[model samples]
Target: MGGRGRAYTIVALCLALLAAGVVAGVEWARRWEGSVTLLGNWTGGDEDRFRREVLEPFEREHRIRVVYQGSSAESQVLAADVEAGTPPDVVVMPGPGELAAYAGQGRLEPLDGLFDPDHYDPMWAPEVAGAVHWVPVKADLKSMVWHPGALPEAEVARIARDPGEWCLALESGATSGWPGTDWVEDVLLQQAGWETYQKWATGRLPWTDGAVRKAWTTWGALVGAGDRQRVQRALLANYADPWGGSDPACVKERLEHQASFVRSGAHWMAVRGRYAHAKAVIPGARRDATAWEVAGDLAAMLRDTPGARALIRHLADPGTAQLGFTANRAVPTATYDADPMTGRVDATLRARGTMRCWDASDAMPPAMRDAFHQAALRFLAAPDELPQRLAVLEEMRARHRDAAWLPTVCGNG
Candidate 1:
């Protein structure tokens, strides 16, 4: 071979080797010290707590750098990122309903090999295997009743029988009318039981069904007229803030059915514990009352880098449960017995209990969720317009056939 040819070959080999070394070095650095970006709906104080108690610990233990970005309305931000093709590595949201869109679009990776969900609590009813799209990092039991110690079961019973004693916060900023929806879900459980609850939530049962019509009618009568004027007056008379101020007088006047986190608010006087109180007030408290509720959080994966994997692993670890609670995120699927961190009673409200997982709204698809929220808000504003409101909801559901067609993990076959 000629000298010049030999020299050219050596140079080519050297360049190729250098390029391979650079790629290997970058991958190694990512494994040991690269940064993981995370996004969440928790901003300000909530965000700081998560970093201090959750993210910081993970970084220290794994020796990986973390870039945590938080916002009060992260859903909008997430949509924008997904559109721009620059999403974060990991995301933590309130429920799976929202994440289903991303997963169905092939943006989210299946979490089967990521964690052993069985090791977690069993309150998640659809079961972790069926809910393979997302893993719940935290949860707050809903379907609870709140009232001051001054108010007794008898008082609540009277209020439940009389519409006048009903009080609702029709004014929750941006997410207005959520309180009303809470009432609807609780009432559904009381009137029809879990089987009915699943059917209605998954869109299997029409809104005009006898059971549904009764629920809507009952809610309408609370603020409507005819012979229920006295009841409506009583409900309005006690209408005040459910939270804040020296006392949650509204909760005291009647019964406040809300999520377990209400205990942290200033107005919360007392509860039987997280799950018990919710069960006690619902119909069939003796038969089906439970110390748990269907609950779970949506963990969004923004960027698919190595750093993100570390964050997911750390947060999914059972050891991190306490840290999440301190951050105001209830541990998802927590057994109702005794939470060592918060010292709250954690036990099934019923001797033979069933813990149904998944929030009704979060399980619905995008169009249906928006329609449900809007329809509820309109109905609350004008109780007399219930027929029109129901029509709108039905029409919206019809328009979004895709959402209505989603598979149900647990529902009527």
Candidate 2:
């Protein structure tokens, strides 16, 4: 070979060796001292709590970094990232249906043995299409009516029956009208039992079905829907604010049909918020309305990187169940006893044989869930339009009959 040709070959081999060495170094760092990116819909104090209670410990223990991205528009952001081929390493979001859809598209990595099954109920972290997909990290309980000040169950019961006697707040930004949906869901679960509620949630039960429509009518009557001035005020009021959007001076005398998370509010504390099972006073409630409507923040892996797997294991650790409520019965009871209200919520979450159905909209396909939220707002504005609203929802459901829905939405069955 000529001298110039030999020199060119040597240069090419040197470049190849340099590239290979660089790739090896990067891979080694990633396998040992890597970072995982996470996305979730927790912002402000919620994000802070998650960081303090979960991320910090995982980082310290695993010596891995967690790059968390918290946003109220978590669904939209995750969808865009997935389409752009830049999805996070892990995603922590409420509503398993969303995760199930990704799992169906083959966008998610099968999380088969990353966490111990003994820490959670099979339903809390169920398999999708024969492969384990997600694990629940936190929980929220519905089927509760909060009242200010201590009152006998009978007194709370009597007040629950009158729409005029309740404090209602319906607005939530971009997801306004969800509070009404919660009311309808708890009412249905209290009236129809888990079997019917589960069917309705998974789109097997038509929205116009007897029980479904009856639940709508029940909520309409309970909340005085279509009282325009009152309805408008509620439609503009924010659900998370203190006083259920009523005057603070009079909040102590009102009742709010909300979830367990709101127990920490100042108004609730000032008046000593107390809860009663919605079944106790809901109109036409079945004698045994044992199913509780609940929400959960479920963790799923989108990238099969080693860092992501380590993060998932840390999340499933029993000690990480320090979130206000845990589905993991193995978590110590003291973890929840920080306050009486929280302790009670945690106890209900851990109660054996107590069924927990997913929050209806939270368990639905994103499109269907968004439509349901709008339907609730419209129903509040025009209670007379329920028949038309039910027809619309049923039509939408029929179109998406084969959508990826969670195999089992309720636990402890």
Candidate 3:
């Protein structure tokens, strides 16, 4: 209880206080490091799988906390957030056109020097000026025809001639009629080829062009003007439900033309499905030609930060890109062993050069894209109104001609 004892006690107290401050500072830094916001259109099982497989691993490795916002109306949500001056650090949108619009408006951060450029196809990460704006995280192969199993050439031909033997769905709630767009786009790609398809998609070619007109008529002959009862069912049915349900009565003998996601879905498993490229089934399809329609979920940084950049880097890694069931072969990530259908799709997507093409509607300006969908529905309801539909689409294209349209949606190599 002398002067020396009091001095020693004061020194120990000072040391303890310093240690506590240090600990608090470290804790605060840790909390700050572990936070990022991501916006995407993956909900339900897709969202859950992503969180478990991709985000959780990234979080564990880097100690970053991801704030994920998954919505069916992701574009609307993102627009609201951007307008409010509070966009997420990163966003994974399906449409490159929408992402391009955001990039043009300076809402996106340049993803320069974050990941290897060679890992992705040029079409997946189109450059703005000299900077890449986004990277594909997931891709779906469109222009595929799904059947219960492999059928003979004769059976295939017979089914192609009968509209009643086809499964068609148009209703998608707010996005109603996009399924029909896929049909016409695939038909165009198969009937005319990528050159003409790309030109029309980007507004370089008018909708009234002979090739475009033929594409529409070809689709009309196939489905749009086909059977009345089947068309009615297609008009009322939800697009996803056809691929997700096991209604034999509705789907029997009916081959479905849908994206590759159908093979990875639970309903496809229940039905024991199989698929062939659309070109193989389309009547009078060019014997020497091959083309594929594709769609992808692209990741772009909106608010650049260390955490956001890290997340982007992870997504850009070819190894990480395969976390989801992507049809992209450029990303050599994990493969689904049990799902052979996805394996076939992955191989088809990986095929080189102009054989692969992005979904034309997805690559078009938003207004034109929506118009395309509505036009599809209209054309289906009244096949005789093809001229009118073509005229209307031409008007929409003219209105948005000056807007940003991708110069290319396919790679030469």
Report the lDDT tens digits of candidate 3 across residue range 1-413: 99999999999999999999999988875674568999998899879989988998888788899999999988789999999999999999886988877887888999988876676677878796457898888888888887766465456656877776777889986678898899888988998888888888777999999988888888778764745766777888887766445452255645788987776566566767777778876765776878889899899999999999999988876566264556345455336554666656676666556477889989887788889989988888888889999999998888887787887887645
- Which digits, one per residue and each the tens of the lDDT, describe model 1 over residues 1-413? 89999999999999999999999987775674677778887777777787888887887788788877787567788889889988888888776667766776767755655666554443332332234555666656566665555666566654654544544555544445555665666566556767676777767777667776666666555433333433333333322355444543253344555666655655554443222344454443335433234455656564566777667767776667342332122344353334441344232311123454356766777667666766666665566777777777777666665652335423211
The number of clashing residue pairs in model 2 is 0
Q: CA lDDT, every prediction? A: 0.58, 0.83, 0.80
Cα miss at 214, model 3 (Å)? 1.2
The all-Cα superposition gives candidate 1 an RMSD in Å to the true structure of 11.2
| Per-model TM against the reference | 0.74, 0.88, 0.87
Q: For this target, which candidate reaches the highest TM-score against the unseen true structure?
A: 2
Query: By TM-score, how accurate is candidate 2?
Result: 0.88
Pick out the ten consecutive residues of candidate 1 with the lowest summed lDDT: 345-354
Count of steric clashes across candidates, in order: 15, 0, 1
For model 2 the local lDDT of residue 248 reads: 35
